[model samples]
Structures are given as structure tokens and as C-alpha cells.
Target chain A: MKPRGWKELNPGAVITEAGSARKFKTGSWRSFKPVWIEENCIQCMMCWIYCPDMAITAKDGKRGEFNYYFCKGCGICALECPGKKGKKAIVMEEEGQ
Target chain B: MSASRVVAVTGNESVAEALRQVNPDVSAAYPITPATDIMQRFTHYVSNGKVKTEMILVESEHSAMSACIGASAAGGRVMTATSSQGLALMWEELFIASGYRLPIVMSLVNRALSAPINIHCDHSDGMGARDCGWIQLWSENAQEAYDNTIQAFRIAENMDIRLPAMVCMDGFIISHSIERMEYLDDDAVRNYVGDFKQLYPLLDIAHPVSYGPLILSDYYMEYKRAHAEVMSKVKHVVLDAASEFERISGRKYGLFEDYRLDDAEIGLVVLNSAAGTSKDVVDAFRDRGIKAGLLKPRLFRPFPYEEVGEALKHLKAVCVLDRADASGASYGPLFMEIASSVSPYSPRPVLLNKIYGLGGRDYLPGHAESVLSELAEVAATGKVRTFKEYIGVRE
Candidate 1:
């Protein structure tokens, strides 16, 4: 007399395999990580403010840092940095796991 | 595509900057308001080697789409951008690209369609191309616009769903407005979006496959029917890409985002920039003792019907707002859609249509407040229109 759950859900109704276009991911899995530069940090918060997902956060400015958990390793912060700070400051490199 | 930093720039620059970072193999685009400069920026990226992609400034949006089709067919990661009439012109081929199942991504700078010929923000342009078999995503602002373009590649390239996508942002408004957009790095975006792999290509001589083949009486309907079903299947892939993008970009780019809808008894549905305006209005009404909320549809195609329909059962009334007009119809494109989807349900909300801001008329916070007020007024009276109400039209 128990209610039906996902265990009893019909597999016929669920889409198991879609079209061939999206069967699997085609790109490399190991992407970049953005590391903030404290010296060039003006506290303008462009890195945090500009972050689409708020991956860059508001720290006490105890040296620069960015939240990489939600960070897609988008180098926008590094590219948009006003200074000539390259990978050395906001480095977007593959995390060695 | 390589460099990384925050700098001042407009929406056009934001798009160009984002695409440069994505670095498509071939960017075939025509000059159109707001979106023109993005293509121009790509030219500079090509020249400077910042983006190692080929730039082809085409004569027309039609040719631009065709060129993109060609590149995508050739197993190349291709991109193009357009607005308003340009999108309308690409209507026929739009279906072709999708039917062929090419995962080419394009940026549709949303604009009002013509008769009087106005070039400004509205869902008019993108709405018309809604069912073109492409994955349609409407962005709220320049940051969403920049991020959506990059996200489109991921959604399209996804092997489970081989279809093109239109990463739309309202023309001029988001396309021209200056904003601080977080640009994703090539490596990160590459990981998020992956690359274009043509599962069915016409160019591979060793493993040849026909694209855009003429379907006859025996299999035409079957092919078309399968196409729609394929799109439905791709829905999961879209969500997969969404989760991955959010993981990397730290943004919530989902099919729908609810604004205080959990305990609400009424719902307001909107798309594009209007959702932002509506959210503010919804907040004001909530302050004044109204149980109202907003539902913004991010993806148009593969219409998230079941998800939305089930969500609407709790509401007493619903307001469906569309930036485009489907003349002589009971409601605008969106209004009719929501109504039909909720038909079989017994306790469906009183759906009404508010067709506003055509030809890029200003959509202020007050308009949204007024809309909420009207819906409130209707529920109080137990009466709602089956026709469209043209808001902001002085005449």
C-alpha cells in the first residue's frame, strides 16, 4: 500500500538516450583556475562584481583570493584586469587533482 | 581570448570579448545594430592573434547563417550573430540547420520587428524565431549576454542534443549598455562547452553523411516528428550543460527562476529583460500585502511545458507577458502557449495576456506594477481577458 516512487517509475517514459549530437562531452575536462592578484586589487570588486555566478567573493582584502568551487575557470577576470597582470596574478591553470 | 582582466566596456565589447575567448573556428556575421561591433571586435581579435579564429564579414544575415551552416557542416565550430530582420531572414535556413542537427551557436540581439522599422529592445525578434528547432536562451543583461554566448556552445555541442542555439539578449539595451562582465578563460570555457563534433557530417569523405536531404512522402512526416522528439530528449542535455556552466561560471542559467513564488497564490510569467523589471515590481507589491511572484523562462524552445504547468496549479491567476505580438490571436505567443499547456488541468490559473513594449517602448518598473495591479484587479473581479492588452501604446 506504499506510494510509488522513482523505483517504480516507468523507464519507458524516461528519455534514456537523446540524439547523437549530445551523447558525450567532447572537450578537455581539466580546465583553468583563477587566482587573484592582491597588489593590483583596487577593491573595485570588478572580479567579484563582474563574476556571472558570484564565484569571486568579498574578502577582508587579507591578500587576494577567489572562490573556485563555482568558478568555471573563466579567465574574464584576468582578461578584464586593468593592469598588465598576466597568469602570475590571476592564474587560470588546471588544478592538479 | 588569452588575456584576462576586468576593464570598462559596452555590451557589444562584452560579447566580442566573450566570443574571442571562446575562439570559434569561423565567425560569420553581418553588421546589425548592437551586434555589429561584436563582429568587428572579432576582426581585431583575428588580426592581433588574441583569438585564433577566422572572421568572415558576410554580406547579409542570410549568407552569414549559410556560411555558418557550411562551416558547421565541415565539422568546424562555427558562430554568427544577428538582430531583428536579420533573424527573420534566416527563418527558412534556421530550420534547415536544426533538421540537419548542426550544433552551431549564434547570438540573437533581441530587437523589435518592423513595419515602422524600429531598432531597439524587445523579445519581438527572438520570439518570432522561437520554434526554429534551435536551443533559444534569452539573457537578462550584458553579463548574462556575455556568459550565455559562451554557454550556448556547451549546450549545442552536447552529443545528446545536436542542435543550434540562439543566445539572445535585447538589442541595443544589453547589446550596447556598458557593464562589467566576467569573461571565462579559453581553457575553462573549453572545458565547460567542449568542442563541436559533427556526429552526422556531410564533409567527412571517408564516412559521408547527407545533410539537408530532401525528405519525401515516405519519411517526411516521420523525420519532422522525430525532430521534435529529439528536441525533447535534448532538454536533459540542456540542463546538463546548465549545471556544468553554473559549476564553472558561478551563475544560475536555468530554464526558469522563481522570484518569491514558493508561497504565492498568483504568478507572473515573463522573459528577457522584463523579468528584471517585474522582479522589482513583485517586491513592491509583496511589501503592500500581495502574494505575487514572477516566473522567468530562460529557454524558449523545447518549451518547458510540464515544469511550468505543474508550477502554475497553485496560482489563482497568471499574467503572461510577451514582447512580441501575434496579431488576432487570443494572446501573444507566450500567452497562448501557457494557456494551452495548462488546459487539461482542472484548477488552472486565470491566464491573461499583457502585450507591451512593442517597437522598443520603454518598459519601466511602473509598467510591471501596473500589470500586477491589473491581475490583482482581475482576480478580485473573477474576470480576465482572452485578448491581448497593448500596454504603453499612447494611441
Candidate 2:
């Protein structure tokens, strides 16, 4: 969609379209990234329930993937992930490392 | 024309009756002096099942205005009422209400702002909120208060001018005093102020919309400009609503009322209940062959600048009376607006500012006569001894 001019703006400064916030790429703001390890994963979906940005994606009632398009990499999902023994299901790493 | 019923009611009751007739979807208000009677009477209607409005008795004026904003944003017709301190408490939400373009109607019983705490009639409360972005309507008497309250919903809800509106009447002078006022039938009022239709309702999940977005420097100016554009269009909306109201009730209304202004050399500009007293003095002056006239402004927000300029251009001199003090400014708020409006004329009329009735001082007809006499001297000698004077003050 084309950007609106001052005259074309809404009366209440409203964004009329649903889910328009998806157009803004916020992942670029992250210096660290969350990487998921499927091997040490339990399908508890704790991270899915706790992600503030709705960045965690679930598939077929099981934990699936992270939508990096919006994830700011605050690491809440990794911190809340319940994994086996000493192995973590998710971990935050420096971007481009 | 529909037959009207006349009832003796106070200004507060008139507003409450209008609210009952409109029967908005929601109302959230707190009790405050001068304005308390309005919400109190409306609460009775709610308890008696007279209307289907959902009444929310909020904890504070801030919460009252906040609840109204929430209801209005969700596409519900909403209203509230407040006075001096109550209005001051709702200051923050007042901006949010207008910024979101919610068409919430409010009845503001004008009273003096407090340091010593006095509850009486004055313009201080309403005048203090001039820049809050809501359209303001000043009522002279009980009838005008009732009519303005009904007209306010239509004006605020107009698609081109979707902004919150306030119907203001002098606190004790009009709000407590009983007067004979004719009221339109309930069906007429309901039909005139039709259903509430919103362009972007928060409750419409099928077609969702986001309101009050956080806009940075990239788009904040554009959003403000849009709000300003809508405010500029309010004047025409108010006029259209007034004309439609006139058709049903047989009462004519305009942006400002010019009483005997034609062929007058001296003019007095005032507002609210004081205009009633000034009109009587104008008649007395006319009997003695003095060309005195009164200009009472009904719409104060989108002030009829061009019309006011044209009205005062022919007069030799004009005195602008203000019930609120601007404190430290050369002229009061009303006087400054009047001066700016008439400054473009080739031969501008000599203008004087008379700050009076502050903190609910009694403004009698004799006080108006004294100001007119001063204006007559200015008109004759073509010299203003002082640009501003305090009327009725001992020292």
C-alpha cells in the first residue's frame, strides 16, 4: 500500500487494516537471535504461551517455529523452554556469528 | 410543525431531559456541584427503566471521561457531565477523547475555578479548556441549554466533524434557576438524532481497526493536521444541525445572536447568562435614542470570526465583556479573539476589554450600562482611555 499524505489520514489517527503491524520488521532491532533445537524439545508449549510478541509459532498443537519477521530476540522463549537434563531446547546467540 | 410541550425546569433538568430523549448507548459520570443535578436526574431515568442506556457511575471524573471514550470508540453513543474541579480532573482524558475523534457529548456547568473554593456561575471552567480540541457551545438560558445539548449530539457525530462537543451553561445562575422551556416529543428527538454509526468501530472484529497508534516524527504532523481539518469543518456542521433542529422545534438558532445590532453605532459583546442582562440594557438605551446593540456568541469553539468581524465593522466602538480573567494578558480571552477578528477592516471599530464577573461576581444590567456609557465616550472622542478595565471591582 502507498503511504498516505496528511489529507488522506484517518480522522482518529486509526490504522484501518487488521494486522498491519506485521509490515514493520522488528527483527532487525535484535543483536541476538533465538535458535530452537528440535531434539531436546518437549511439546509443553510454555514458550508459545509466554512470547510477548507472539513470535513463537505452533504447528498441529505442537511447538513449531519462530516467526523472525517480528521477533525482537528478547529471549523470553529460550528462558521459559523446559528441556531435558543440561541441554536447552532454545538458546540466544549473537546474530551472524 | 410538531406541537411542543412547555415545562418549568432548571438548566440541569433540561440537559437531563434531553439526555433521556436521546437515550445514548452509554453514560459515565461523577457527581459534582452545579453539574451534579444533571447526572442525578439521569440516574433516576436509568433506575426507572425509562431508557436502555447503560449507566456507569465511575469513581472519578477522569475515569468517567475515560469510560465514555472507551464506549464511544467502540461505536456506542456516549455522554457525561462535569463542573469546575471535576472538569479539571478530566483534563488528560479530554485531549484523548478529541484526539481519537470520539463523538462524546458532555454537559459542562460552568463554574469558577477554586483556590478558595466557591461554587458559583462563571466562565473560568470552560474558558480554561479552550485549547482541548472539543467543540464548545455556550447557552444563555434554560431553553438554550436544552436545545444546545440536543444539537450537540448531531454536531459531534457528523461524519465530517467527528469530534467531542461540550454544551456549557452558567453554573448556578442558569443551572439552578427554573425557567419555562418547550420540549420536543421523544420520537422527534430520537428521529432527529438518528442511530450512531461509526466508520471505524473497535468492536467490529470482522473488520478490525487500531486507534490511537503511536506515531513518530514520520506521521505525527499529518495526524495532527487531519484532526485540525475536521475541526475547521465543524462550523458548517453546527449550522446544518441548528437548521434541522429549527424545523422540528420552531426555535431558530445561529452561531451568534445579534440583538438590535443593525444601524447601531455602539456594540457590546458578551456571552452566556450575561447576554440576557445586556439585552435589557440595550433596550433601555434605545428608548433614549442611543444606538446600542448586543452580540451574544453561542458557538465559542469554532468562533464565527468572519461574521463577528462583519458585525462589529459598522460600529464606532465596541466593548467586549469577559466573565473569566486572562490574568497578566493585555486583554481577556474573549476580547483578544474579538480584536483579532475585526483587525483586518479598513476602518476598524475602537475596541475595549471589560473583564467582569470573575469568581461569580454579580453582573447586573447597571454594570452593562456603565460599560456602554464608556463605549459611547470612546465612540465620540475616538480615543480609548484604557484598553482593559475591571468592572464592578471595589478597587
Candidate 3:
């Protein structure tokens, strides 16, 4: 993005509008991505409660997929996921793979 | 103008009187030598209900400045006081306060930094923070110190130039020595400084604003550029405030004060209390038929370069004295500034630098006489001697 010139910047770099933090995308910082396997899932909503970035998408009390735009790939969701036996619902994978 | 009382008090007492009259909303301070008296006296007013200021006695100078930043962001008139090491300790917060555009005022009692473990008057402390984006007003004595303290409020709080300012006075010399000064009535000072109008105050909850936000590389330079642009407007604001202050108290001020410099062939540039001593020597040289004058810079940061250049360009020889040494740079800070300002003019004056009075050594009148004599000789012969030399140091 072409940066704004000095004249356009606000005095003291103050952000006048609230919640401007949403404009920045932090997901690109991740080296690993969280992969959700719905086949082994038991919709416990634990990932939603454990996700630090609020990147877990949900609707009407049901667990959904990850919002990659904001997720940092912390693997917290995969760690918190309670799935059947040795098969976890959420797993971490290298971003490129 | 209202009636003001004449009082004999030390610089710290006079500054405390000014703070008492203006009665800022918050003052967060930590005690240090030479400047401890200013804050200590102010706290008495806070205790006796002489002024309604919230005094936060912090653990260190760093925390004092931190509390000042928080209080100022919350939209209150804030002030503080410190000396040498204390000022050094608050170094990071100095940039933060100015960068955030907080109109905080500080009374900087100039003292030497530690290492020799000294507590004495010198310009090292204030000179060290010269580039921190705060407006610096140098005062010659108790009277000027008190006047500058009162004027800093109006200048810093100016909406067009919302930057922090420091009113600097020599430690022990002006800070501790008793001098006679005038005090404007409390009502006059109140009416003069008026009220602080906060810009994007954090306390204005209905209209939310975030300060010191995380600005990445893409926008950080632009923000700094904008900050530099604001400083370009401070010179005008300082003058306007001085004029307003003149109305309340009949003392006039300017970016720099010229003493007998009109058509002067020999000149000297000095700062703070040394200027007071240099003026008498200038008169002595005048009596001896050597055309001598002096220029004492009142506004050091965002220096009045063009005006200074114009003032010194006519002289055949000019000497710049620095109370603090810019070690390894060879030339003193003031000399470098004067050299740069006058670089463009044809027939530029012969500029010399003399490092003097470090660690509170006495600035004697004889020292000024010798420097002026050198200027006289260089002007007459049109030849140069050593360009930079340290004065008052034992060989």
C-alpha cells in the first residue's frame, strides 16, 4: 500500500476512530495453519473458548471453521479440540503444505 | 495590566509562586538536587490548600514523567520539575510526551550529569535533551525564569502547537541564589494562561480516541514528519504568547535578546545566566572603543536561525560560548548552530567556540573580557587564531 504523506497523518498520530485495530491483518505472521477435520469432531466449542485472537468462527452455539484472516496459527484450538480417540478434529499443518 | 508585588526570593521560590498562582491541575514530580526545592515548595501549596493541584510523589524521575503523561492524556493541566540526573532518567518519557503532543510544562534546573558525582549548575542536562522535540526556553536569572515558566503554559497549550516545553534555569546560580522579581496577581496569571483545551483527550469518553498507537513502518515516518511540521509553527506561537504575557506583566521577550548588537563589529553569543555576566563585559568593551555586542538565545530548540544569522552577519568576528561541551564533536553545540545559520551570508563573521563553566565552575566577568578582546583583535587584524578553545580550564 502507498503510505499516506506527512500532511495527511493526524496530529500526534492519534487514531480518532475506535476499533481501528481491525484494519490490520495479523494472520500472515503465522508459519502454521490450523486444519479442521469435521469427520472426527464433537462440537464441544472448546476451540472457540481457547482461541486468543477470536479467530474461531461459530454461529448459533455450533462450532464452525477457522477465520484465516485473523488466525495466528497458535495451535491452541488444535490442543483444546476434544475428538474421537487418536483422531483430533483440529490439526496444525505447515502453511505452504 | 494588573498590579504585581515585588518580592525577594530564590528562583525555585519564584517558580513555585508562579505554579501556585496558575495552579495547574496535576504535578507529578520526583525530588532531585537544585530542583527538589521547586517541587517541595509546590507540594506545600498542595498541602495548605494554597493551590488545588494533585501532587503525585513518584518513586523516580521516570515514573514522575510517566504519571505526567497519563495525567496530561486525561486532559489536565500538568507540570513537573527536575535536575541533571533526573532529567536524564526521564529521557524516554520526554520523547513520548512531546510525540503524543501533550502540553506539559517542566521547570528544568540545569545541573551537571553524574560520573564525577557532582550536583552543580551546567547546561549538560538541558543540552542533552535538546532534540527530544520539546520547546526549550532559556532564562538568565530568577526574574526571567519565573516569566518563562508562566509563558510556557500559554505557548505549549496553544492549540496549533500542542507540544511540551521546558523553562530552563541554571542550577544553584538561578535556582538557589536569591533575586528580586515581580509576581503578577493570581487573577492576572489565571486570566493570561486561561484554560487548557485538550486535543483528542483520552478522558473525552463519548468521542473515543487512542494515543500512542502502534504505527508501523508504512506510517511512522509520516507521523514524525507531521511532528516536525508542528514545530515550525512553535516559533510564532512563542512570540504570540510573549506578547500576551507582556500585556499582563510589562516585561517584553523575543526569540533571542540582542544587547548593543546594532552595528557591532565584534560580537558574542551566549545562553542562560552567562548572558547576564557577558552583558556587563560588552559595556566595558564599548567604553574601550571596541565595537562589541552580545546575542543571548532565548529559544534554543527550533532556534531562530534566520534572525540569528542576520544579527551576526554584520559583525567582523563573533564568539559562541557553550556551557556544555558536545564532546568528540570538537565544536560546541551553540557554535555549530551559529556556524550553520550564517553559512549562506557573504563575508560571514569569523566564528569561534569557547567551552566554559562545566560542572558549575564560576563564569567570571574577566573570562568574557578576554573573549571580547580576542574578537577585537581578530576583527582589527582580519586574521584568525585558534578556532575552538576551552576557557577557564587550568592548563
Candidate 4:
């Protein structure tokens, strides 16, 4: 839909709906993406707690999946992952690879 | 036909009395000199349980306005007050409050901006915020201050003009000086102001809304245009409110007051308390058959251009007395507005600017007399010795 002009806006130009930010795919901003492996995942939830975009989600009694729709691929989750013996549970991969 | 009583009160107390009667849902306040009396008196009403207003005692003027904005956005009737520096501190949030279209009413006890730290009456504070999108009302005395404060709510919350408003009274002079004023009964005030109808309250989760969003090149201008459109509609709302208020209080009001301007050859345009002094001088000039008149603007914003232009167009000469300095401009702020308002006319009046009473200096009747005399000379000669003059300044 074509956006309305400034003169068409009501006062304050308030965004009316809740959680409308989800409709915007910020993943397009990512040049590299994080690939997760389940074997080395300890489910410490550090990635879940520290993810700025709340991209990492957790389920009961297990590690969760990354909702990349909102993530910008900052690699914070991969960098904070504590896999044993220097093995990273999450690693960055080039987009479209 | 609301029952009313006459009371002796200072301008600050008068504003407080009006606020108490309106009894807004929320009031956020930080005290400053001259303006401090307003919040102080209002606080007493809060403590005594005379009103149900949630009084938020903020640490600074910025927080005072910020809290008022939040409360207002939350669908509560909100208000606050401040003076020179306090108004300056709230400068940023002033735009935010108005841009959000929150109907917040503020009492700005006009004071001079500090360089040497003066706390006296001047137009510097109010004039500085003239473009901040708030409807501005200047009061000539305690009675007008009380009346304007009550009218501000109706003007600000009018459906077509939901912008914040500021009712300004001269600091120290009007704010502290005691004067006789007639006040409407509480029920009358409440009924006149009516209930505050909030547009998009944040607490309305059923229909959630996001305020103060980041709109870039796609729609920033549109939001500003919408704000401007609402402001342009303020004049009619102000007049309607005044007319209704007159019905209840029996005191008439207008965009500006014309005192003996009809068939006058010379006129003086001024604002606030100085207008009172100018009126006395105008009467004196009239007795001498000088045909001098005075035009005092009650509403400064949504400036009554056509009204002002037409009023002055017939005059041979007009002098604008501005209490605030426009610093380096050929004329002061009021003069600039008058100049532009009448600019389209083909044989405009020989307008002159006089900067007077800066930093609370005395604006005596003699000083006004001097300006009127000068105006008469300019009218007779059809030429001005100077475009602008600093009145009462030591040579």
C-alpha cells in the first residue's frame, strides 16, 4: 500500500497497533547469520538473556531456536556461547551461502 | 448565571484558585520565584483534600512538564507552572507536549531571562516560546489572569484544537501584587471547562497506541503539518471559549482589546500590564484631542492578523511597545508580528518600535506618554526619527 502523505496524518502520528514491529523484517540488515548446533548446547540461557533483539527463544527442558526475523546478526549469542574445549555451539555463516 | 464572589488575591493566588476549581486530574510542579506561589498555593489545596488532583512534586521544571505530558497522555487532565529559568529548562519538553497534542495547561509567570540573574517581569520567557506550538495568552491583571487560566482548559482541550496552552502573567508585578478579582463558583468553573476528553490515552490497552515514534523522511513533515493545522484552528476555539466564559462571568473578551482606536490618528500597541498604563495615557491624549488609541492583544498565538491589520490600517501612525528585546532585530518581537500582520496593506501605518521595561524596569504612565507624544510627531511629519527606540534607557 502506498504510504499517506504528512498532511494526511492525525496529530502525533501515533502508531496504533501493538507488536507491529514484528512485521518489519530486520534480518535483512544481517550480512552474516548465526548457525546453531544442538549437541554442544548446554542451555545456559546466556544467549537468551543477553540477546539485544530477544531473537533467541527457549522452550521448557531444552535449548530454544533463534527467531532470525528480528535479529540483526550481531554475533553476541555465538560469542557468549560456552561450548567445552573451545567448540562454539553457535557460529557465524555468510548469508546466501 | 453562576454565582460568583469577589476576592482580593495576587495573580499567583488567582491562578491557583482557578486551578483548584478546575481540579485537573494531575498537576506536576517545581517551584521557582514569583511562579512559586502558584504551585505552593495549589499544593495546599491538594493536602487539604479540597481537590482530587494527583500532585507530583518534581525536582526540576523539565521533570514537571515531562510528568504532566505522561499523565496527560495517560488520559488525565494535567497542568503545571514555572517562571523564567524554569520555563527555559522545560523548553525541550514544551515542543514534545504540544507535538503530542496533549491538552496540558501551564501558568508561565513571565520573567526576564538571566544574564545578571534578574527575577523581574518581562516578555522574554513567554516570547521565547512563542513558536513552540502552544496557544499563548497574556494577562493584563489578576482578574484577567484568573479568567484566562480557567479558559485555557477549554481552549486546549477543544476537539479541533487539542494543543497545550500557556497563560502568562508578569512575574513579581502581577504574580505578587494583590488585586481585587471576581471568581466563578467551583461548579460553574467545572461545568464551563467541562470534562477533559483525551484523544489517545496510553493506558487504553484495548486500543493500544505508540506515541513519540521515530518517523523519518517518509512522514515527519506530515506530523508537523498536522500539528500546524490544529494550531491554525485555535483562534476560533479561543473565541468560543471566551464567549461562553463571558456568559457565565459577565466579562467580555476578544483576541485583542481596542481602547478608543476608532477614528484615532495615532495608536500604541502593547501587551500585558503595560497596556493598562498605556490606556491611561491614551485617555489623557484623547482629552487633549490627540486622537490616541491603544491595542492590547490578549491572545498572542494564532495571532489575529486580519483583526490586527484592519485595526491599525486606518491609523496614521502606530508604535509597538515590546517589553522583551529581540536583540539585533530592527524591531522587537511584538513589533515584528505587527509589521508582518499589516505588511500586505498598501499605505501601511507609519509603524515604530519601542523596547521598554526590560528586566522588570518600571513602565510608568509618563513613559507611555512620551511614546504617544513621539507617535503624534511621527504622524504629523509623516516620518520617523528612528525606526526603533530604547525607552527609559540611561544615556
- Best candidate according to lDDT: 3
TM-score-best of 1 and 3: 3
**Superposition error at B118 for model 2 (Å):** 1.8
lDDT by residue (A1-97, candidate 1, tens digit) is 4634323422112222334323322223327767676665656555665666546667585335565556667678777666444323465666674
Which 10-residue span in candidate 4 chain A carries the lowest summed lDDT?
Answer: A5-14
- Model 3: per-residue Cα lDDT over B47-157, one tens digit each: 999998999999999999999999999999999999999999999999999999999999999999987978998898999999999999999999999999999999999
Tell me what TM-score chain B of candidate 3 gets against the true chain B.
0.99
List, residue by residue over A1-97, the lDDT tens digit for candidate 2: 6777999877878788889888888888888899999998987888899988867888788977788988999999899888878689999999989
Clashing pairs in 4: A6-B222
Q: Assign candidate 1 its CAPRI class.
A: incorrect
Q: Which residue pairs clash in candidate 2?
A: none
lDDT preference between candidates 3 and 4, better one: 3
Model 2 off-target regions past 4 Å?
Answer: A31-44, A60-65, A82-84, A87-97
Give the chain A TM-score for each candidate.
Answer: 0.53, 0.88, 0.87, 0.82
Highest DockQ model number: 3
Native-vs-model 4 lDDT? 0.91
**How many steric clashes does model 4 contain?**
1
Candidate 2, residue B18: the lDDT equals 97
Model 3, position B207, has a per-residue lDDT of 87
lDDT of model number 2: 0.92
Give stretches of model 1 more than 4 Å off: A1-97, B1-8, B385-387
